[model samples]
Target: MTVYDNCHLGHARAMMAFDILARYLRFQNYKVNFIRNITDIDDKIIERANENKETIDALTGRTIASMQEDFAMLGLELPTHEPRATDHIEGMIKMIGTLIDKGHAYHSAGGDVFFAVRTFPEYGKLSNKNIDDLNPGSRIAEDESKKDPLDFVLWKSAKPNEPSWDSPWGPGRPGWHIECSVMSLENLGKHFDIHGGGPDLLFPHHENEIAQSECASDHKFANYWMHSGLLKINGEKMSKSLGNFAMLKDLFVSYHPEVIRYYLISSHYKSSLNFDSDSLDQARSALTRLYQAASLVPLQESDLHEDSVKGFIDSMNDDLNTPEALSILFGLAKSINSTQDAQDQSMYASTMKELGKVLGLLNDSSEAFLQYGADLTDEEISQKIEERNQARNNKDFLKADQIRDELVSQGILLDDSSDGTSWKKS
Candidate 1:
């Protein structure tokens, strides 16, 4: 499950990664129950709400809607269940009670309840770090009332003018870690096939979830863990202080959402993807190649190459190696372009589109994808092509060349054939 607080491209990478996995699993005939949770209430939500001078619901609601829109823009499949942290408060309260009863948690003199990390012997198993190796006071939040510095809070005491909910201990909210644990367990039960999130969450956030859930239920947590690597701006980590962070909406103004999705999926999910103009240009160029080849062949309802589909499924099965899968796609596109046989071209195009659909690419018409984000419409380009043809027919070679050059300047490439003229965005 993923969390949301001003969701960015980094978050989109993780979402797309799991989305592809879910899609592939369903394609493989698995009954996949994908769940992505929204962290509606948290320290960040409170801080942002107070700063914006708005109610928590108002801020969270707006942000959540915007996030959903962004996900759809990137072609992400909606999850099976999307639970908000606030909606599962009763389950959180009950889980915290179980932890306290199980001696894995305690209420401090202050209203907060803290988890006893030392009691959980396998606390650092996921991260593979020893408790003794941890810096004496490193990574632990500053809270003086806790018995130990590493003991994280399960429930946070409400401060003045903060959002509060009814609880046995007092009016407070669950801590960040407890929210995911209760939500996942209540919805997916004690055991699920797999759990996934961003790499950063694996340490404290997911680590804490495992401890709390396992201790509370005396059952194992998720069988497998999947974490997508972080996204960087240029060559460095994206942070507000660095001034290199790019928001999703801002990127959409400069590039098509499909282009951004292509760039994000060009690399392996476990590898860091550096965002740069050149990388985006490469993605656009590559997608242009696929669309150009797609345009050469007529749209067929069914025509597939068994070998190509097998290669695609193999690459996807091998840990979802999308980069390799794309290589197969590009190779098929090359064959489609080189082939003169109409039947073979159609078969190649069908195989390419079928494989690309697995990765959510090439679904748009060639004209649509090629002309997207262009300054001129198809009719405008066609009219310009007609004028150029008339100029050529009148033996005005210079005028025809000039018209073609003008269209080229506008990012349109015109191809003159005996049949007529066809155009595409450069």
Candidate 2:
């Protein structure tokens, strides 16, 4: 669960993929110590900070806070540990020293250090790529001072006014890939349960990490490697250059949080999710039915009934099949809506809650959520109630009906009882 917020809270597709894997691991009773590292001191961070006329600390801090807020809105739990690259300089330096001692890294004349990719026998095992076949492209250039063109930098020579740390190599900072190696080793030990990120990291970033960690510790880095698919906008890769990238904060203003969450989770973890306003609207409408059904049923504690909830659990267990699980939930919602018996409705309600506990959806009532942005004052609602009561008492059915219609249009539902009239948000 190592996420790099290179642009922001990351693409929604990446977050959904992590959420599914985390939920599935927890369901299977695994003590998963998930750690998502933050590359707070990257080249991009410095560039963005400079463009905004802000300090590096301020840029990273604000983006991290916004990322946490997005995670909360999606109902995602925080990672066990969040290590920032700037905060773990000591740990990174220690690991780099170990690599240098093990002859896996070398120092250049200009005070820059690079990893010796040729020294590692299984260099491209994780990515299943051959060093001979790797097209260096623009990533590798002719720096005659270096041993090999393919070898990437382990420590960079700092420039004036840029962030730097004191190291044996020189007064420089750790490379982008080294940060994860150090953070993972410090937080989750040399060998951890799982390592995950976007599919794009499988190449240079993750491959380089393997080279550094295994060479330093002489042990496996992660038992399992998982990666989520990239997000596209309308069948095209999202990029700032193309002007197709959508900001998470901008989208949040127009769409409900649950709607966006549903859209992200509807597709499989390893599949690309093409984001659009229409698709999100469809997800919102689909989830609205579940919320509407849940609203009709009275609230009750979840009851354990494995037999009835097995479909939902089985779908989730099969590599977190959220689409299938949602289908099962829809079927249950239909059952609740079509049934009339009081006892059956109560049983259905309990079953729905039990299923919702696993899916992390349909847990909130429609009434409660629809009241998210109401401008009406409490006194106004009370006055309307009083007027409705007065109309009913005076036997003016037409006037009472008009008032009730106005309330309904404003997302309020009124139920008339013999004793009085009760109201709730529609």
Candidate 3:
């Protein structure tokens, strides 16, 4: 994740998708070495720091802390090695030198180094675009220093008051593309099992990484690439102009983090997710049903691996079909609801949670999760229930009804059985 600004739902979706993948893989007994890189030094990071009147280190440090806090709240797994781009500049310089030596890169007259797209025949292999048909940003535009519009900067010439590192191409920091190329090769070796990011990275960012890494190392960069689908806002692309752009911090004020996660994984990872208030409300209702069912069960181990659990594993094995996996879990919840047998409900709930662990959810105590956003504390709720009971015992039907209605307004539902009264979040 980049450290230029606060993390938003788009960031959360991509992160949660990958985190779920890692958890499922580990659940299957696979050793997962997950590496989520931090792009600490970027053009936007610099611009934002300057705008905030803070030093670059101060800006990035604060943002990284905020990112960590947000991810942890969403229950994302920490990466095995979280390498910052700034920490891998020396490796970037070494790789740039190698590319230059191999005639795939050149230093321009402006004291900048650029990768020659013409020199690498597989320049557009990842994006599957013709070199002539490509339309990159102004950074790759035809210029005096850049021989072709397709050529991209490996190292930039130092500008006034900008960060720089001493290199053969003079004192300038690495460009955006070179950071991942060098960092991935340095940590995961020249070749790795998988490379992943959001679908937006599949274009110039990933294409450039491919060209530069392969040309420099003379080998395949990654065996496979996995990109999660893009997220949208109510059938429209997210933009500040749309007035629907949201940040995770802002959304967390209204919805539970686990609700957000459940909503994100409700669709296939490769399918576009449309975010709206209604979708989140539905997600909350669905999760509430699971917790309500679990409340009837006593905690126990699920070594039996019931049919629903097998179905969940099947769904997940089919390319992480989370929507179907969730459906299977809901099936178990259905069994718990339909049956009066205590042992059956306990078995189903236990299996449901065993599957939920793969999705990083449903482990919370039933009362805690069910009453997650309730206005009253547990003690307060219990006191209210007792007051209502006393009112009923005194034959004050009006007083008892009033208390019950007030608690319902605060999302505390009451169940009056022959024995006594019990309360739960609505």
Q: Write the per-residue lDDT of candidate 2 for residues 3-25, one digit (tens) a residue.
A: 22334223657766787677667
- Stretches of model 1 off by over 4 angstroms after superposition: 1-6, 239-242, 376-403
How does candidate 3 score on lDDT?
0.86
TM-score of each: 0.93, 0.86, 0.94
Cα lDDT, all candidates: 0.86, 0.77, 0.86
Candidate order by TM-score, highest to lowest?
Answer: 3, 1, 2
lDDT of 3 at 391: 87
- Model 1: per-residue Cα lDDT at residue 303: 66
lDDT of 3 by residue, 1-426 (tens): 779788888888788889999999899999988888999998889999999999999999999999999999898988999999999998999999999999999999888899998998877887788887777664355567787768888998889989999998789998999999887888889889889889888988998999999888889999988899878987876644456678888877666788888998999988888887688889989998888888887887645446787788899999999999999888888998999987777788888888888898897787677667676888898888888789888999899899999998878888878867776666
Candidate 2 lDDT trough over 10 residues, lowest sum: 1-10
- Whose TM-score is greatest here? 3
Off by over 4 Å in 2: 1-10, 138-142, 371-426
Worst 10 residues of 1 by lDDT: 1-10
